[model samples]
Target: MTLRRLMTACVIAAGIAGSASMVASPARAQSAMEAEIIGFHQLCEKGDRKACIRFGILIGRNEQRNADWRRAHADWFWFER
Candidate 1:
């Protein structure tokens, strides 16, 4: 194969190898969910629907089920958006 083709193949292989080694642990997932909730709350304070829905989903089964679901439905306008 040509040098250019070999380099392209190497780059692709490297990218796949790098991504394969990348794993999101449960701890990382929890942390990300926490951050997302915080950011979503902030956005809700400023009135953002999509973020609110995400926030609700992240927290609905937590200590604020009713409230979160309410906001989620309201945010996305479960009846009408």
Candidate 2:
């Protein structure tokens, strides 16, 4: 009986840990992307022409991925160009 209880507790702990990681995965990805963009932008600001183009391209691609966001920020996109 004691061994069975230990096995069940281990399973439950594993499941909780797995679900928690799944939930945080997307948030981590978004932050990483944001950080990458920020790095490109900083480099661009420091007069790196290639970084400027890369930053613009990344922003454009990201904006195009979400129609509603693209529409809402249409002018900002044009201004960036």
Candidate 3:
């Protein structure tokens, strides 16, 4: 993707991640989803190699109740192993 597209996707991912966790009450499942998404986005943007794997693991383990954070990012291979 172009830099503009990557940046735009980054911004959207941030919004999705933030919106999930900003809920006032932990009683809400959506809050957990939001928080996880936000965290995954954070780790991905920060280039946490483990977070990419972990994010997928989260979705696989938690299901929709926690949001599908795996789809939020594509692997950027050039800088990675």
Candidate 4:
């Protein structure tokens, strides 16, 4: 009975940890993507044409319905040429 209780506790702990990690995963990915986008924007500002294009493409692909997205769209169009 004691061993069974221990096993059940371990399973519950594992499940909680797994679910917590799953919840955090998307936030981490989004932050990472935002960091990449910021890096690309910085590079573009410093006259890296390739970075400008890449930044534009990344922002365009995301397609956020926000001012930032609109600004990025303009930047992309300006740098696309």
Number of clashes recorded per candidate: 0, 0, 2, 0
lDDT by residue for model 3 (1-81), tens? 599999999999999889888774476355776687568757977999888877656666766533433344334323433
Residue 57 deviation, candidate 4, in Å?
0.5
Candidate 4 C-alpha lDDT tens digits along 1-81: 999999999999999999999887774344677788879988998999999988867876755633465665576456445
Q: What is the TM-score of candidate 3?
A: 0.36
Q: List where candidate 4 sits over 4 angstroms from the true fold.
A: 1-30, 65-68, 71-81
- Cα lDDT computed for each candidate against the true fold: 0.71, 0.74, 0.66, 0.77
What candidate 1 gets wrong by more than 4 Å, as runs, is 1-30, 61-81
Candidate No. with top lDDT: 4
The whole-model C-alpha lDDT of candidate 1 against the native structure comes to 0.71
Cα lDDT of model 2 by residue, 1-81, tens digit: 999999999999999999999887774344676678778878987999999998777777855544544565576456645
Please list the residue runs of candidate 3 whose C-alpha ends up more than 4 Å from where it truly belongs after superposition: 1-30, 62-81
Supply candidate 3's per-residue lDDT for 34.
64
- Cα displacement (angstroms), candidate 4, residue 19, comes to 28
